[model samples]
Target: MAQSGRTNSVSISHRSTLFVIPKWYNSATFPKDIMRDNISRREGLLMHNKMLFVRPDKPITSVKNNSIRYSGWTYVGSANLSESAWGRLVLDRATTKPKLNCRNWECGVVIPIRHNDEEKSSYIPSTRGITTSVAESGGGNTSAGSDDGSRVASVFEPTVPVPMKVPAQRYHGRDRPFFYMED
Candidate 1:
């Protein structure tokens, strides 16, 4: 397929992206999204061209130094490491095994924010420019509890106690079971 005008391009308009970076690059503080005109088509097939960039304008400035895709990444089985090794964990809620209880390997969903692993931000900060911490957010407890410096509270939250009324006309007699229902 002879393609023209297919140069790597990115613009900050109305769009979402999931910028996956490796641990090594993540340490150096690189923004997940390519913040410059560095989209290079290192390889790919047909109309599906692969993009390569570490701030592509500055390949030397990668937040993660290793490969992002799963095929090239190492496969540590769902054992040995009880806690997930950062991005090494793929979360699955249905897993009975504790080791594999990390972030789920979701398919084709866009992320809301691009995290710069080297720096941190506060949630509605008094001032927005403080690089304070990395990934230490709770689900915002609506109920009070003793903070024993434990993660048991974050692992699960108490279900909202408010009475949720099921709209009668919403289902309309179609007996399609809920998503979790199984035959």
Candidate 2:
């Protein structure tokens, strides 16, 4: 999780960026009070156009929910926004190049942004798949998580498609910062 004070540390709006959050995560594990507090702090910076925050029109968990459609790409997976899950930065002495050390067996489906008719796209499974003209293999477990050749898939995928929501609505508070929600 990003620190609230760290919210003032960078300027990504100059490049046009936004952060999207779910309307409600499972409160049994993540409480509502904590969500409100973090949103409150970040809202101040977002209000000035430093960046944007969005919530979905329907609870992302509901299939019948009114989903917002976006023109850009999307990432669907169980990974968090942390360095460890994304991959830790490592300096390679031999090549003198920075590399992302991916030690865990993590996988995801990345949908690329298609802006025009000339653009072509495909979704490939990271575990095993055919090599295509547009495919690029990234980091993965070197040993396949024990040489048994058979392993169970991780059961930790998020219940809701967390990244599919678009900016919709936010409650207007005169003295408080506003967060975005998808309608």
Candidate 3:
């Protein structure tokens, strides 16, 4: 599929709906023009089809009958639709998600990466930054809690030490402050 040497042609039939995915494509393997042509063949065309979910969105499962006419739900996952037919990689009865360009939270958030009107993302950032957690608050060098659940500080680290004791006032019946506000 190298651009230097590639033929833009493939056979298709009106029989079964083509479940297109990258089978064999790589930098050294598929050149620019060739990759473009191949992608144009399926991915590009499918992308233009509004009825189909483009990008990483994939079916979760397939329930096939005991016949050759059709099968079950053809579930898809994070394998990224490589140009290879790895139906075996499809994990049955497994907990998974259709690979997303962003995360679950970032899903549907729109982004303006291009000048054209067509180049708009379906998702938008809910906040000013991509700070997932306090640890990720500082440019990622500051990691979240450790595997053992130890704390990791961020730019907004506590200014005062926790469990600070307020000045105690003498009272008739209290030596320690009442833990509950109701009393």
Candidate 4:
């Protein structure tokens, strides 16, 4: 966990592996120098300028009065991590020719964690679980807890904190992404 003033950064390490997220470039909530150690040498930086949603585990009641266990999900937007979102070249086996296939609209996908036997076959198991901690501004003490006071472990391993709030707020009526206009 990285600590500076009232800001808290979560780092999950097990065995010899460490996952660290440096401070975002233009964040209003967490300023620069939020990380405890210098991370300029890190291989990758999360440069997406979009919304992130995080939801820890929770319980819900079903229509049949049964308790439903909610795990979590990971969403990848088209603009950020989809090869089809940009463009991909493929060889047409039937036609014996090469062609380019492109997705013309914005899209995203939400992958849910395995929660039952039916999902066991389809869902992949994650090797690492998520652990979070918030430290005091100056005390530098770290503990494990999230907004729900529970540790969120995904069926998909190696979870990292997104550069946004947990359980992101829904967009209001007027909220929309910017689009190009020819005017």
Candidate 5:
């Protein structure tokens, strides 16, 4: 879900929720103003009376170098949320694992979901440079149109990388780090 476009506005509805993984790409396609407008409109206004989740702290790095829209249990892999990629998942009745019938090569990481991990799932990074107020206030970009009307264009705001503090020991036992989300 690139922040500069209106594609996501279609997928949201009363019965469903949309969680947008954030991005830091500076291309014109993902402008900061549009991103702010989106956060304000979809998240701030509490669209659907509170369903959309847009947390810029959770930056998603994709193989295509873009942000992706994620929902619950369904994993769309590296593919877009299109029919071909999402329509083929079948549950293995015995093992309870999801099986996919793919039309092309794709990649995804599957992690077992635990319903009780609310603390970790809801921990929004407050120290990160960007905040909900920043996104809602149109932090540093010029927005040309109203939220009800089509956005003419948006300017990209360059972001400085925040350094991370090292812990005494690794949190995850594995060599690589992983992120987990719950609904």
Candidate 6:
């Protein structure tokens, strides 16, 4: 979910959490008011631009007494969080109707992390730059067990090394996020 406003003005409910991941630059020379606001309000973290990983602590289960549950999800692509990239609903001037107006060509894939009913384990979807595991002792080692001794496994092995720092960094007071048109 995205919003265009100050961080303090937005109120997130207890049932939902928000994560804001913005682009990172090497020189760290641009003005990053957005990142600074997010950090001041404790609303966001810095992550890689090429990849996104979302692992919920608790799985979302079905409400109809079914065994199905969703562990997590991942999004990888070229779409940035913008109206032109994701499209915006606008009223058509000629037709008096509402339509989605997108100015840019963007594409992305959202892969859902599924819970394996047959194996009774959580299947974490692996990506190019993220290390995902559910180890037995909660250590960094890759294993096929959860902290509670339940079986857990990766659906696919991570093919590439992580490009950025693990456990994404928070913006300090002096830190700044890069802007493309900054002069």
Best by TM-score: 6
**Segments in model 4 whose C-alpha atoms lie over 4 Å from true places:** 1-53, 57-67, 81-104, 114-141, 144-154, 157-183
Q: Which 10-residue span in candidate 3 carries the lowest summed lDDT?
A: 147-156
**Candidate 1 per-residue C-alpha lDDT over 1-183 given as tens digits, one digit per residue, 9 for 90 to 100:** 011112224232211122222342245675422121111124221122121101111112224645321101111222222133333445456774445444534223211122233322211221222211111222223123212112212111131111111111111122111111122
As a whole number from 0 to 100, the lDDT of residue 34 in candidate 1 is 17
Give lDDT tens digits, candidate 2, residues 34-69.
Answer: 122122223434322121122211112323543432
Candidate 1 wrongly placed segments (more than 4 Å): 1-38, 42-98, 107-183
TM for every model, in the order presented, reads 0.15, 0.28, 0.14, 0.28, 0.20, 0.42
lDDT of 4 at 99: 79
| Candidate 4 whole-model C-alpha lDDT, 0 to 1 | 0.33
Clashes of each: 10, 9, 24, 2, 1, 0
Scanning candidate 2 in windows of ten residues, the lowest lDDT window is: 147-156
Give the Cα lDDT of each candidate.
Answer: 0.22, 0.30, 0.21, 0.33, 0.30, 0.41
Q: Positional deviation of 126 in candidate 3, in angstroms?
A: 46
Collision pairs in model 5: 1-67
Model 6 misplacement above 4 A: 1-49, 55-57, 62-65, 91-98, 115-163
What is candidate 2's local distance difference test score? 0.30
Per-residue lDDT of model 6, residues 1-183, tens digit only:
222122334343211122222444443763332231112113433232544444444566868746777555566689765565778998999999999987788778777666546534444433222333211212233333323212222321142223332222334544333334434
Q: How do the residues 58-109 of candidate 4 rate in per-residue lDDT, one tens digit apiece? A: 3223446464543455566745423545577899889979877776666776
TM-score of candidate 6 to 2 decimals: 0.42
Candidate 3 lDDT, tens digit per residue, 55-122? Answer: 11111122353222210112223333323322334333455644423322211212111112232232
Candidates 3 and 6: which is better by lDDT? Answer: 6
